[model samples]
Target: MPSVDEIRGRIEAALPGARVTVEDLTGGGDHFRCEIVSDRFRGLSRVERHKLVYAIFGDEIGGPIHALSLKTLAPEEAK
Candidate 1:
């Protein structure tokens, strides 16, 4: 199981300057909710934006990370 900070690190690495937040949704590292805001999401569809984040975890998706819910946004879309 990955720690929340570890998950956040991976996302930060993958998106460089992205603003990312990862939470252990169920008090278990396997379940997470991630919010990411980045310039890279510009011009991409919602699914495409999610795929960018998912690509970073690759095989880990069904392994250490059992459930990952995402809120991906471009900087302008962020609150």
Candidate 2:
């Protein structure tokens, strides 16, 4: 299981300058909910934006990390 900070770090590393917030929803460190806002997401569809984030985890999504609920947005879409 990945820690919240570990997840946040990976996202931040993958998308530099992104504003990322990650939480361990289950307290067991497996389930996570993350909101990411970045210029990198601009012009991308919702699924595309999610794919960018999901790519950061790869096989971990269904392995150590059970679930990752994402709310990804471009800078202009954030409020």
Best by lDDT: 1
Candidate 1 global TM-score: 0.96
Count of steric clashes across candidates, in order: 0, 0
Model 2 misplaced stretches (Cα beyond 4 Å): none
Give the TM-scores of the predictions, in the order they appear.
0.96, 0.97
C-alpha local distance difference test of each model:
0.94, 0.92
The TM-score leader among the candidates is: 2
Candidate 2 residue 17 Cα shift, in angstroms, is 0.2
Q: Model 1 clash pairs?
A: none
Worst 10 residues of 2 by lDDT: 48-57
